[model samples]
Target chain A: MHDNAVFSHKVLPFFLLAPQLIITLVFFIWPAGQALYQSFLIEDAFGFSVEFVWFENFIYLLEDPEYWNSVRVTFVFSAMVALVGMILALLLAAMADRVVKGASAYKTLLIWPYAVAPVVAAVLWWLMFNPSMGVLPFWMDAFGYDWNHYVNSGEAMTVVVIASAWKQISYNFLFFLAGLQAIPRSLIEAAAIDGASPFKRFWQIVFPLLSPTAFFLLVVNIVYAFFETFGVIHATTLGGPGSSTKTLVYKVYEDGFVGLDLGGSAAQSVILMIIVITLTVVQFRYVEKKVQY
Target chain B: MVENRPWLTVTRHLVLILGVFIIGFPIWIALVASTNSSSEFVSGLMPLWFGEEGFGNFRRVLTNEERVLGVSVSASWMMWNSFIMAMVIAVGKIVISILSAYAIVYFRFPFRKTCFWLIFLTLMLPVEVRILPTYEVVASLGMLNSYAGLTIPLIASATATFLFRQFFMSVPSSLMEAARIDGAGPFKFFKDILLPLSVNNIAALFVILFIYGWNQYLWPLLITTDENYYTIVMVIKRLMSAGEGNIPWNIIMTTTILAMLPPVIVVLGMQKLFVKGLIEQEK
Candidate 1:
């Protein structure tokens, strides 16, 4: 606690952090700064001259119809996946919470998908959703239903959503299970003594208290959907069947990386960053207040 | 929270079991599809037994034949690349995080708040924003098609640093004081006492980063232009496409199963620590 000891502490920390800072700056911070710089201009595929065009890249991005389509698809995918993923996780968590025996086995089985790489998951889902040879589609035909994901945009969205949800369900379950265990047993017993209906008791007691955990899952899931679904979108659809599956991240990758429009890509990245920062700020500032924690 | 109402007991059981089955069904089908032959798989039969096609499917998967899109040599190489990159990144992250976290927790530095908040800000910027510029940096470093390109950049992990910093801050200050009074320096104090006590945090970070590395798609896809640099996931994808002859459902599924095995084994093996590790952070 003395001045010399405290000051010495500074030296060690600075030395340890110095290498990491340079690395982070060279790799992360500076790239992000460069992306910000590039967003103001236009450039060729190989990133040649990059003539500064002021706000023209932003103007083009905002006015583009494909860009808007991606925005809509992104939010829809995020909402459905996050909301459904949370509900399924909550139910599973509640169920796992009540198991008298073999809880570990159930937990092991349920959380396995969380371990599967998204790339592999994308492959599995792609093979599973294949029209002719896909197991699910085969079953659909066997059961006397015409199922074609290619023609139906809803079905295509559903396929990706299900794949996404399958992975998220396990994660949500793990977190929710932890949150469930953390809730004291005495609280539920008190609710019972008040003669609250089972449904009412859950809504009034469990749901409200569980909001913080739910909010945690919600933010994570939204972020996961927003950014992480790129591989699946790339492998399975390639934004195909008339570009129905293209989301925000994919759009950025397409414009920025694929189209070789470095400025446009950089611009998209900036917009994406702004949107994420704003959403995160909103989550932390307002909705987080309702969370019990 | 325990419910006094017995109704929840049955309802919970029903819902949980049902959810488990639905969750498990697709995987079951995947396993089944892997077991059967191409014809049986295409037929989508429900019968499950040791089929004559199991070995046949294996042969077709490993060998190039009629209707069999071969699992490329790249599968093995990519798996190795991914495994090495993932392991190094994981170990590097833990070490860097330990030092950074220790400092943030035990020291009173001037840029302390700035360092901590810098990590928080990075968390919000997902890989997409950095993909373009990070690509430029990686390519410029001449690390393209090299292991350094895959692993080194990933070594600067903000998430791990943040998690460890947060977790270490919660360790009782008394432990550090006791060690310090014994004339133990910061490094000795951390190595001997602090690190040993934080196994659960280490395990949590390991599981998280392992999955992150396993699932890293865009980075690998972009960084390595060569087929040899592709991971198993990419291998499966490249094989399953229509151009490489008939995309065997069985071969693809088997490849998928193979791709999934390590991570599945890891999760199942470490399932106890998986939940316990995360929950421990709450305390």
Candidate 2:
């Protein structure tokens, strides 16, 4: 009964948490666990009742070349998006910081890309990048590059990466600008007084202080690349140009929802979860420790 | 003032202007696209300015088979469905996370640290991992295609819990103590004292969660398959691959513009809240 008092104290909290717990278990945990479990099974594509076929879905997925391709695709896409996104965001944020006036107006303009839905952004870019009529293509042909994302896998991948990065750079800029503003101005002044070159001061002092924020954004940008940018890929590339841009998430959508291979798709989803969890664990256990608390 | 450097200042302004134009141009395209007629769009050329076809395009988008929302394609049904679903999730998350955070942060509690880490585990196991089984679980519960199935499964928001804990931990303990000293019960102390202080966080959290829920394509696509149950995003996606007869760029752009409204409004409206909440990195 002594333990009951603590429970009683939690009565109010229990009420508050109950709804969240119930919903989380229902919507969040259940679907994910279901996906993981089904990854091991082979279900009739048409019907619900089926024999419990264990590990068959996974084995089949392993043999399917597309499955392995998706893993590689997910990696390359995420790496490119995350790395390029961080650099662009940092540069833009740095530039924004140096503006003498109308900083808010500049930020508002800069963040407009983030405001558009991924579908709209993709479509907007699609229209603007259309080879015959797209502004970029139209302008580039004046210089004779003959750029078109529709036919070339590399070009398609480049478009996907650029679009994803463009959307994300605004978010990163917001985070980094906030981070930069939070940094003490005195440190930079001191570095300048010591006759440190601007680049050296940025590398040594500013970059180190920005590590925690960078670390936080690394996790965010990685996840965004994994889950969020699927819309962009779906709308923009449709995993096209010979499956060059076929990301794991896009594959999951195509296989499970589009192709009716729910079991096999679940297997890929499980792999995605594993890669992300492993990355996160590594971040917390190793990289996070080095983040200077 | 006499010491001001001209070259650096001019260079900075130039960079800022270029950045602004890059970021601003796409939106200009979207806004302009809405104004364009189908003929104008297909003519292989569109000026940066408006085209006066907004009404006509809006009509076609809503009436076309490709219409993703409203009474037409039953996507409007999904919008309301999503709005309700997201609200339920938002309310559930905010209440649970804040109270849980309050329990751990403001009070002496047993196993509080363990609870913290346990909740954090959800952050690792994403909805993507367990989505298939959760589908079965909902099906088993006979909640398939039901409102409960759509809303309940993804309700445990690790992000909300995490943010709330961080916010609550920063709150001064003296306030809680004073409320307790005033004979306020735990409930009163929590409700009367704690919840008010966290309103800004709640607002920020609400916008983020709402947008996340609103934009969800995979989960909703997987769970609800009925024509009457598609979300706004689902509609846009469904319209994307339609036959050549239905791929009207004008209508697509119009509906796309429509779909963009809620998140845009939410973000623009709560700009200050989001700005305040998202603290910049300290150097």
Tens digits of lDDT, candidate 1, A1-293: 32223224658897777656766777778788988998898877665566889989889989999888888999998999898889988978877876876787778778888877665666677666767656677778878977667787888888888888888889898888888777777877787778777677668887887888888778778988988888777867767668788898888888767688888888888888888887678666644464353
Per-model DockQ against the true two-chain complex: 0.51, 0.41
CAPRI verdict (incorrect, acceptable, medium, high) for model 2: acceptable
Candidate 1 retains true contacts at a fraction of 0.54
- What range of 10 consecutive residues in model 1 chain B has the weakest lDDT sum? B41-50
Residue A184 deviation, candidate 2, in Å?
2.0
Residue B253 lDDT in candidate 2: 64
Q: Cα deviation of B269 in candidate 2 (Å)?
A: 2.4
Off by over 4 Å in 1: A1-10, A46-49, A142-144, A282-293, B1-10, B39-50, B56-74, B243-245, B279-283
Tens-digit lDDT string for candidate 2 (B154-204): 667677776787776667666666666677877776677678888888987
* Highest-DockQ candidate: 1
* lDDT tens digits, residue span A127-180, model 2: 677665567777788897998787988888877777787777778888888878
Deviation from native of the Cα of residue A268 in model 1, angstroms: 0.7
